[model samples]
Target: MARWKIKNVSVSGVAMAVPKNVVKTAELGLLSQEESDVFDNTVGIKSRHIAPDSMCASDMCQAAAEKLLEELGWERDSIDVLLFESVTGDYRTPPTSCVLQDRLGLSENCFSMDIPMGCCGCMYAITVAGNLLTSGNVKRALLLIGDTALRMGSMKDKSRVPLFGDCGTAVALEYDETAHDIIVDFHTYGKGYEALMTPHGGFRHPATPESFEYEDFGNGIVRAPIHTLINGMNVFSFAISRPPKSIEKFLADYNINRDTDIDYFLIHQANKMIVDRIVKKLKFPQEKVPYNLEEFGNLGGASIPSLMVTRIADQLRTKETTLLMSSFGLGLSWGTMCLKTKPMVISEIVFL
Candidate 1:
């Protein structure tokens, strides 16, 4: 296997638009005790970025991609490939990538597609771009991922109300001979499919009025029974076990176990608890882990790259730093990559 280097990896654009209104956990006091407890404890989310009534995943993604292209000063013709990775796509038929390409005014020569991974999407997309760049077929690739599932229901369902937020992130990858080394490893375990899933609205179980009806969970808070059933314990257990295992496997593959050998660790910002668990279990240094969940909640597929753009890219001082990034969730999938790179400028686009 030839080692592919990620040269000139820059986040050309980053923009996030939230619902006009913001809901806080404290505001959920009107709900029953069990409801409030689940919202506050398991979710551990104080607030999340809910999209406006009119916005969908593609709308936010296009807005972010436009800003990224503007910042990079590159025309649509320069991009050879466009990948939109998201669990909540704009439509079921025509892939969301097609809609995004047309919306962004990319040339018809550009190849566009969608990756259906949920939270691990950003990492998976980056891995694909890295391979394409290394394969010599494409010089520049645009990767975008986001989700707007938070708008699927009212704020009454405490189980999900605080667990999701909406945001889009774009990354520009270019081929550079002098760029840093990049290595990626992806893994999946499908046995736990029922553990965490949005069971309705897919080919397996098409959406029906029955799926939308309310069901009592022995509490005053009646929720759409099959909406997004996330067995918190199962999800957490899988996350805690898999992420560190992959990270360890990566380190062992490279024949090193020292903490200082790695510069930064960007784990998927699923929740503060998962972040803490991974760091503790791996015994990774505190500074190595970069977390922004408290501010952004969970941006689903966009979480990892968005953190890199917002937090990591700006603070990098030299080009030799070794960074480790991993994302896990939905599909019960996870991916880890070890990248060595030089500092590069990332443009920040203001989301109005």
Candidate 2:
């Protein structure tokens, strides 16, 4: 695990965009009534916004960036950096950031790049952008992070389909001399990478005949190597273990009082079970923790910002809110951070 304190950077605004299509678990037809009820009550997913085949992660992100830039009254030309973070990109090549730069009308000198990450992408991307800005080399940045997890999963895979949603979120950041410092702690477990992965279609295992073969895992879980596959037991175990420990250590190491210093705990919306466990272990009041999983399902890297836009936009828009954010998933990695956000522009949820 590693931690860093980034200074002179502040969150300016946040915005989120989701597909117009809504998939309610009860209507998915993949599960029986009894099963659906159990899933709703346990996993806590009621519906998920799934993007159509025609819309990619980049499109949603572009919409979000447009709205955010307009709301923040930020000039496109002033953006010194643009970070596109997500596992899903517009294409396998040409890097999605290049496309976004052209689409968003960023200046030719803008330092744009892509970070292929899952749940922890937002924090990681923010940390990277903060570094770029701290040197005064980059003045402003647009951090676009989200994923269409369902687009990568088999429609027939009940285990994954109902728990994943499509969302794109944009966060504006700028270098400010008076801004409070941002503390970030990041950790990774490479040995547990297989806990959550899309087994094929990478340079690693390149496409093989077997990659296309779909196997029924029984009980309605069916998928191929080309689709996202999650080892439930492995992920659940890791989620309930590592994240809480990291959060506690971050608070203690930074001399932060989780109960008082933090105004909100924006935890990753993995699932009710995983989230509930972590909150319980940390002994934080349920009211301090906000969630969006019930309506948007799990949005990978977009989870944290999506929560801000959907659940606590009012608070964030009204006053400075100290936040303790924690995220864990995909690479079997987790991150925890403490930051303060002044009353900022948090736009209404955009449905595309």
Candidate 3:
């Protein structure tokens, strides 16, 4: 129930890095001909980038952050805060953000932390970064969020396998005293936490040999508890329900006109179908909703930033537009935000 407005912060730039490897849902033997057709035509997944086995999520993030730092001409020491948001970290201990600080050659004084959440993470990281900058002590922050959700599922599991992609992104934010406020509305429903989770890898179900045994979950879907478990129906229900409702309330409460006040509605690219449903539910214009999942599948925490970089980089670089973003995912957590974007250096999507 966190409802607040934060000011004095603006996103300076956004950059994303995805693996060079391409994976088409059609190419993966996981889906049958009909499923593949549906996935490509209606569900919006055509191809996705898959990191090599040797690469971890942090590697992609570091690549993105490295390029962003260079482009923004930001010296390593000037970044006072860095937030890494993702469930897939290099290790369970030390927190990935701390490790990234060393890799990126950031100053030891940087306040770094990890937000171990998926999908809705980028915005959450922005929220944390904004708060820190407004505290009057911090100047600049690098907000990184992404994961290898595509790597979490067994290759043969058709249902979940084709629906995810691997990615890493960085959204740089700096304090600007005259910047307009960012309004965000947050909602949490712990009841849906189990709807999307790896039930066997966390503390309560720490890795065990028995956990590696694959079990069939019907509909040609089979996986071990160690793999990411997504209850499609439940997740779909939550996605199509909560985010739209929350966004409606967000717009209404702010007296923002969807048709005139906002230039774009950049939703977490879960899929074309889900975005369409939300669009249909809200009676929002379809043309203003830009999407990239058609080529990249669903990129977990990286979706929003990736979406911005891939689909609207040029517009964001030159136009001062109003945007409303809605993101929802695991934790049954979701949020809606509206901000008038200033000119930002949006880098082209990088394939590492």
Estimated TM-score per prediction?
0.89, 0.98, 0.98
Overall lDDT per candidate, in order of appearance? 0.73, 0.92, 0.89
Better of 1 and 2 by lDDT: 2
- Candidate 3, residues 1-352, lDDT tens digits: the string is 6976988988899999999999788788878788788879988889989888888889889999998888899999999998999888999898999999999999999999999879999889988888889766899999888898877887768888888889999999999987888998889999878899888888899999988999987888899989988888999999999888889888888999999999889899988889999999999898999889988889887888997888888889998978899899989899998887899898877788
Clashing pairs in 1: 19-50, 319-342
Q: Give candidate 2 misplaced runs (Cα > 4 Å).
A: none
The TM-score that candidate 2 achieves is 0.98
| Off by more than 4 A, model 3 | none
Ranked candidates (lDDT, high to low): 2, 3, 1
Q: Residue-pair clashes per candidate, as listed? A: 2, 0, 0
How do these models rank on TM-score, best leading? 2, 3, 1
Q: Which regions of candidate 1 are displaced past 4 Å?
A: 1-21, 28-44, 152-154, 219-221, 256-258, 317-320
lDDT of 2 at 80: 93
Candidate 1, TM-score vs. the true structure? 0.89
RMSD of each: 3.1, 0.9, 1.0
Stretch of 10 with least lDDT, candidate 3: 150-159
lDDT of 2 by residue, 106-175 (tens): 9999998999879998999999999889867778999999888887888889888899999999999999
Task: Give the number of the best model, judged by lDDT.
Answer: 2
lDDT of 1 by residue, 1-352 (tens): 3233454453333444444455565664545656656655655566666677677778777777777687678888889889998877877879989888888888898888899888888878887777777656678889888888676543566555666778877777777766666777788888888876777777788888888887766533456745776677899899999878877877888765547678788888888888888889988899778877765678888887677666776565335567788788877788877876556545563353
In candidate 3, position 100 carries an lDDT of 97
